[model samples]
Target chain A: MRKRDLSQFFKDKRVILLIILILASVISISTIGIQEGLDLKGGSLLQLQLEKPVDQDTMNVVTTVLDKRLNIYGVKDVKVRASGDQIVIVEMAGVTPEEIERLIGSPGKFEARIGNESAEPALTGSDITNVDMYEITGTSWTVPFKVSPSGAQHFAEAAEGKGGEKVYMYLDGKLIDENPPTLSPELANGKGATELTVTGGANTVEEAEAQAMAVYTVLKTGTLPVKLTVIGSNTISAELGEQFLNGAIIAGLLAILVISLIIFIRYRRPILVIPIIITSVSEVLIVMGIASIIHWNIDLSAIAGLIAAVGTGVDDQIIITDEVLGKNTDNTKRRKTRTRMSVKNALFIIFASAGTLIAAMLPLAYVGFARGSSGIGTISGFAFTTIIGVLVGIFITRPAFAKFLEIFIK
Target chain B: MLEKFMESYKLLIIIPMIVVILSVGLIAFNGLNEGIELKGGSIATIKLNEPIPSPVLENQLKTALNVDEVDILNNNGNDVTLEIGTEVNPASFASALSGKGQVISYNSIGPVLSDEALGQVYWAMLFAFIFMSITVFIIFREIVPSIAIILAAASDIIIAIGGMSLFNIPLSIASVGAILMLIGYSVDTDILLTTRVLRRREGKVVDRAKEAMKTGLTMSITAIASMVVLYAVTVIFIPQASTLSNIAAVLIFGLLADILTTWFMNLGMIRWYMEWRT
Candidate 1:
């Protein structure tokens, strides 16, 4: 049978592939879509150093709890993981440092006592207005806390019960009880008392004051059941991250330009240029889209992965170009055979190479590889996007190359 | 010169026999340099304010931690990497070392993490094989070339990994990436050779294969050069980047071996099969 219009070669299958791709591109753009990386959309990165002596088991539990808390706090695209023992890295998209500090740093260690009115009186350390480490002329250091007017009234009323029996001072409901008097009349006005003293079993007056200060902050917040301590706090300012991001963008553009120029010089035609350029651009876009969709925080490691992908993708495009131009056997309408062979080879190599990378990355992103959800998502996002780029190359860019080759490649 | 060169059977049989022997030996002894990620261990990075003698710090740490299996890798004399494998209380060790010098960083993964990482590596290799075979079969419509290419790619990776193990180089996440990278490189060269032969060019099939090799070799060499430079930079300049540097080293060796196995051994076997079938 005679070959049916070899010149109009890319008619049936090629057209169908193009329609599918165009539809996909349109759908992706229009929909409630993926979340772009922190690099594209700004976010907060908080690095906390746990107090020494914390093990991986404790860190893991803390990480899980923090993740749950952040989710509860309405921080979307949150990543909570341990970098190692002692440092937990938290990445929260659209969260401020102050919010993170507030959530993670709750100093709610207090001694509270139950009264008739309520189970416990909420008294903050700050409520104990004055803590003094005073020394009498010949005595050792003595520390005392002076209550506010409201606290004084409550103290007086409690002391009146049971003949000047000690009204216990509590922090977070812990009892710090001391007897003030043996008579109700004596306790009522402190008339028989030498001096009213609120003290802890601490070594010196300084220790007492420090302990009081620590308790004061937690009581002031009045938050309960959530015990959090800020061991370490750091913030990467939005402005600096933005400047770094702009520099990265410029670097990426320059890399693409240099690479395209090199490919053009080596291949010496616009035929190869079209596919290489398209695939390269599509790789970046698809990676960004995947990062957005997967909510991967595109950090510096991700940027490195992208640059590496561009290099690999360019090499693949060159192979396709070389296959088309340098090796065509069919004499009668050889261009058709060449185009067919090139696309077939391009598709094969792209699929094979991308298959391996995807296989490797899928596991990295899965439950098995890195226990934490940080590195895997970012690094794997780059791989996943590049693989998508290859698919896009198969459908859009390679066919685009075919059309260009038909026009430009003699 | 041509007649004399053609008599060299060393290129045909001996080299492959050597490769097989070397690959087997390495694979058998691969247990020695089992990756830190695979074997549960402690990897510590200590950054000093200034360069210090390795022995002084090494001895201090070794005596303090009571660790004998410690490697004091002075990275550019500025950073020291100590990998401790024996189980010791990490906090106690860090505290003990902190007295001598500041402990900049340390990471410890339980046996669970290592087991998980190994499992993932296994699945990744399996998925790669299945995916490559299916895709190649669709594109080529010929199972023989596809199978040969896949086998060649696998052989290249195994040999690369074996070589790394034999050389006492730690198999890392980067090396895993390197193995995957070689799969692409190996298949590319095999496909290039196959296409040249299938085109039925004006010259003899063998002659065209040689011509394809010229181009394929150039590409491989360039790639090897780049990877070599990358390896050097990773190893020499970036001490912390163990994974990336190790991967570059594997790729350099794998791509170099691939030029021979993929382009020649596998390509030769495929052509022989095709001729035999016809």
Candidate 2:
């Protein structure tokens, strides 16, 4: 052969040696399981964009409060972190959607009042409603509601003799302010509208409006001093989760069976299928087991990654099959050497491709840390498990592929 | 014999043309759907305290958000995924949900994130290209032959992306990953052809091309068979066509095109390059 016709990289049968390395890598990876994420295991992915651009201080306070609340729901593997601008992400394993709603719902409001005086309250704002606002004077307002009929009559009789005495308004039973005495008003048909006026407090229109809404919501829910609006809510049915889990298991098992058949048919030998099955199963199992050990929550995305890995493993096996068959071709003397060369080249491509994909997924998995992007933890888990599978494909499974190929072809 | 051989090579150029035409036509007629990731939108979660009647909250989400294009999915009984349309603004989305039920959490990915994603996609493609060029040169070590193979791979990628763009399969991060995968697959096939030809000495360049073509064609068909089956199952299992599915479609197309080009067009070019140099 002319000097120019020779491959620079092919000197000293380097390709054959590289094949051995590839086989070693695959075998090594087979012993280790890749880590899975929350998506694969089934968890909640919650994205919370702030209502307003709150400074870091408020966010810290909210985070602490939310963390405690999430922990209250038995979410031990919970991740609460900040995203870009004014968003927060929370991931918890085995979290039902209902639990998420409760955690993210608005804190409660509490208010209390008694005749001309009041006690502190412990009810939420949702219980309150029917707030009527009346203009008392220029730039002044009075708002009140007939406190749920029972409290109304009780306060009415309490004020019957206490006319000209100051009446106080309380939220969650805490005195908001006490209004100075007004003229004794005539009771219509011996009944009166239970009312209170913010005589000289509240400072601005916004404050007055807020106080009235809070008071109304509290009275409505009949519970507390806070008004809550669910910014985001999702409920995953246990039935659906179970179905998904079943589907994943079925799909996985079917894939294994199909791949095994493929190996047996192509190689025309049962022995060739053994290592492929072992390597494939080991890759997935080890990944899932490690994920459980790490307490990573698996979700839907992680399932997708798992399936993708399954397909990739089969593809790798096909390459091994080609090398094995190529090794035993026309020139038996060069079979070992050529088999090694083919495996090396194939592994090189697999490594490069897997590396590129891992790099891409890593940033996306972490994207949840930035505000706006959701599914951070779930994406991370999927990526993590995927990279693990690819690593095994390169390190353990592929090397084992070479060894197995060597055995079967011989 | 020579005429028969020339006829074999002609099919390579013809097949890719047919694929390009079909891909273009399909993408043109049936527009692609854009996911919320690329376009701005709101995805809200609704939690039912108890197992409510007709547990799927799609209706409630529509009523709460007052939008009909909402995707209300049953999550693991306590939660429903409410993927509302892009028509709703982030502030209004919060307000609308707040008006009805308490919002548990709401996420809005801005137009900027999509832009950044787009920028990142471009960067990835660029990196893949530069890396592929260097890797191909290093691995194959023949300038003209390496360039020929790279050109075929590049053509497959461009045509795939173009097909995706024309089809309006909203470019996504996941799709980018798929395109990279297609690249590796296409290049591998090309290298296989080059390897068989480079190692052959019993025949002319065209003869080697035909010999490689037989094996390359078989590999491509087998791979496509598996991919088609997988894609079918994926479609049936995941009715919602996500980015991953879109990538699968691209891969199938690119792989099919690659087989045609590598088994013939690439072979012709490499043969020509070798003959001219000598």
Candidate 3:
């Protein structure tokens, strides 16, 4: 603790990286202002624009379908109403863009009619088993989908005796394909076809792929109604959100104080403890920076993820400290070599632990990605933040911590 | 050095095993409640204009909404969390609570996306286990030490879930996140112990274990301290967020469970394995 060699510390790449990141994070935070999620912000709002202006009746149908779809996802307290003939406004609290966008983004309604524009779709989306990935050729696209046997039966009955009549594909009452191929002569008498492709031609390959993707998405989501594209989405937090955030902040600060006290007690030296705390704090700040840069809302689950990441960061710090000082405090001629060996060993444990932590976190992140990371920024947000925090710890902060110990612990 | 008692310490592995068995039983019999996040429902908080007991409020809500099922998730003096059933109409809800209380907030959560999400939860758990096992195996490159570490981690999670079931902490997204955090902490201490006890030969096995314990316990207590503060803060300051409360509570349990799993269960096995190997 005697010497203050500032230049060497600055020269260390680990310290340099840590300092740069912490500075960047501070800038990112002040500029972007850490994105508070629904739990902190209260609730969110989403605006959906219908493909075309429809009747009040059609709008009602659209709103009702959207409401019921959210209900299916077990979300209640959602107000799905039409802003106008063309706009449907959905207001809710504690949900994410990913959750709602995945739920209501695509109008799940898919219908096939043999004779043409009719309320009675011979086959509904439920009839389809799965929507295969789109296949693109030049400026044409086809989304192949297979139907259940019963769906095939229903299709046969609809297409019966309609020889040479073109069958139309409709998604949310809009024509998926205009000038569709006429019924095959073999199928003209009502031969059953389980597999069907919604073929579309566009001026450009991108357009064709986009058209095919729209079909694929709608088919995959079970069903959606009245093609509504998300135009705007945001949420406001409840007063409870503010209260919860304050509580979390207070609790977090108190926790940090407790952790610092423990670290101070363990090392019994401000020189060692200060850097440990600073390293962890910087790690968290950098994580918050990355999160803000990516605009990951800081929700309850996300907070949990942050804690999980930082928790391991502290654990690794303890491991490094113990290993570096363990059984080799004597001033042997081999002190530097032993310290290097200890740092290397500590790095091994840090990397191994980081690997498993990330591995454990990946599933929750994957689930959050798949679905259920709804309201108040649930599952996946936690994993996302946790993964980011761990990566920051291992790559940036952990090495800096070791470098700090290497410099002064002798 | 406590070496005399250390011989019998190898038997301590069964303590966590028995705890795990009992935890499994508790979970099986009680069954973990999947929070409304997965099960279709909504949470509404009403700020009381007048002082009302939680049960009284629940009764009023049941009659007002004409729904027989209403749960009082939390009662934080003025802010009472009303765990009302799904499909709530604000108009009716307002009318239902007109004079009784003011509507602070209402969130009606329906069921999660689908069965696929539920399936994904299981898959996620499986993958976490598989990956953790692989990582431990790679680290130790020894089957027994690696498997023991993974088993301890698994047991910590199972016991934590059992603690949840026992304590009525519902399995929600928030609590699941807590469990995930616990998984990391559990593996952390185990890894610390295993690495120090098995890989490092500078000190006697028991001396190395005691040293690892000192470091591991410090890590655990620091974590536990935070969770305690968090839980206390959530309960006292922001009781309306029952979901937030779940995260803190579950994390506390998982961390506490990790201590036992790591120090006793995993440590005993490692010591025994070391002795048996010798």
Tell me the lDDT of candidate 2.
0.55
Candidate 2 all-Cα RMSD: 12.1
State the lDDT of candidate 1 residue by residue for B170-236, as single tens digits.
8654466557657666766777666666645567666666656655765575466556555555455
Model 1: TM-score for chain B: 0.85
Which ranges in model 2 have alpha carbons more than 4 Å from their true place?
Answer: A1-43, A50-62, A72-77, A84-86, A92-235, A262-265, A289-297, A329-384, B1-18, B21-31, B42-65, B68-83, B87-176, B198-229, B232-251
Ranking by DockQ: 3, 2, 1
Deviation from native of the Cα of residue B249 in model 1, angstroms: 1.9
In terms of TM-score, how similar is model 2 to the real structure? 0.62
Q: Across all candidates, what is each one's fraction of true contacts kept?
A: 0.07, 0.02, 0.57
Q: Who wins the DockQ comparison?
A: 3
Assign candidate 2 its CAPRI class.
incorrect
Q: Can you write out model 3's per-residue Cα lDDT over A278-326, one digit (the tens) per residue? A: 8878988998999889887787777767766877888899899988888
Residues B134-213 of candidate 2 have per-residue lDDT tens digits of 77777667888788777777777766766676656655555655565566566656776676667546567666566456
Q: Could you tell me the lDDT of residue B39 within candidate 2?
A: 61
For model 2, the interface Cα RMSD in angstroms equals 5.4
